[model samples]
Target: MFFLQMSGFPGSGKSTLAREIAKFTKAVIIDHDIVKTGLLEGLELEGQDKNIDPKRAGGVAYHIEWSLVDFYLSQGHSVILDSPCLYDVIVENGTTLAEKHSAKYKYVECVLNDIYELNNRLKNRERMITQIGPVDIPEERWQEVINRAKKPTHLECLKVDTSQHVDDYIGDVLLYIDK
Candidate 1:
């Protein structure tokens, strides 16, 4: 069993790659964005915005995602966390949980450095409540955010160039996990 931690910017194809990997490995995916979006939508629907903001929703969502990860791993299922790895806390949690479950810890970082490409994808992609809307963040910050992405220092990380066809690099991920 393996716990694959996905890392990338908002429009860097983290979810797309995670889906492909899940299709092949049959791993259970606990998508952070989906959980956060659900929380935000529930609040908006119930007129409860005063109770929690998007930032808090993100925290709650990650908490839920980690719980699901631990649960699935404990049940003998491989798991994938489809989220940008931006914080040291995330790395610690993922690594510790993997060790606790005696599962291989895998990290895949989708690298998309082109701001125009990222913006175009973000602009046209299916809208999610917690997703960036039409590059709402300043373009200049995109590179900074990408540079700020975090990963485990001691693990061998698979750096996927997002411009390549998934068929090309998906095998590398599979081999990495199996290795």
Candidate 2:
């Protein structure tokens, strides 16, 4: 079994590429947005009057995500973990989890250098209940997100610029995992 983790900013096409790769590899996907949205929906269903705290929801979602990863890995299944993975800790934790399960770990980082294209994609996204919902990141905030994103270091990872065709990199990723 292999474990694939996707890291990127919001409009960088992480989820799209994750779905394509999952289809090709027959892997289960554990998406952060989906988990967080489910948590939010549970709160709403519980009749909680207060607005959900994103930080708390995110914490619980991550816990669930990791638990699912552990379950799938133990069952000898391949998994595609989809998330922004903006921090170093997230990347490190994923790597550690794969190691613990003795699964091939592959990290794919999607990036779009063209801010204009990224902004357009972000603006055109439709709201979905299954997703964390569309967030409008202004130019300045987008720049900040880019500045804060930490690329994985000292790891054999694939970096693809999503501005181009992401499918073009699937073969390369497969080859990397096979290695």
Candidate 3:
């Protein structure tokens, strides 16, 4: 099984492209935002404002995100983890998990050639539910997430600018993986 970890800023098309790749490769997509939203549902967090502790939210998201990946890998299934993973620890975890499970791993970074398009997409995206829970996050939180996104190193990952046509983007990724 191939474990794909997609990292990118919000509205950079990581989720859309991750789903596309999952469809073509028959892999499961584990998205962080979707998981966090689900986890927050019915929870009464005081001042749960977007301005709340970002680190706390990030930690929650990290735990849920990795747990899903570990579960699927244990089941001998390919998984695509989609998130704005700016931390090296998370990336290392993905690689280590793949190694320990004897599965192939690839990190795909989705970049945006046009910032405007990314902003529009983030603001207008329809809710996308997954195993986590609700998929709708507050706009302010979304903005905060994007603002904190960091680019992954290039040594062991393939970077794709999602501003290209869908066919081209997919083709490029396929070719990259094949290489």
Against the true structure, what is each candidate's TM-score?
A: 0.92, 0.86, 0.78
lDDT of 1 by residue, 1-179 (tens): 99999999888989889999999999998889899988888777888755676777888999988899999999999999999888898989999999999999999999987778888989899978679864655777776778777889998998898977788889988898888
Candidate 3: C-alpha RMSD to true structure equals 6.1
Model 1 vs. true fold: TM: 0.92
lDDT at position 87, candidate 3: 81
Q: Evaluate model 2: give its lDDT.
A: 0.80
Per-residue lDDT value at 68 in model 3: 82
Pick the TM-score winner.
1
Colliding residue pairs in candidate 3: 38-133
Residue-level lDDT tens digits of model 2 in 1-179: 89888888777898888888887788999989889888888888999755767877888889899999999999999999898886677777788889999998888888887778886787688744544334566766665765565655777888787888867777876677677
Task: Give the per-residue lDDT digits (tens) of candidate 3, residues 8-86.
Answer: 7767878888888877778899988777665565243544454445467667878988888888998998899888777
- Can you give the lDDT of residue 62 in candidate 1? 90
Compute the lDDT of residue 133 as modeled in candidate 2: 35
Model 1 clash count equals 0
Mind sharing the TM-score for model 2? 0.86
Question: Where does the lowest 10-residue lDDT sum fall in candidate 3?
Answer: 128-137
Deviation in Å, model 3, residue 109 alpha carbon: 0.7
Residue-level error in angstroms, candidate 1, position 13: 0.6
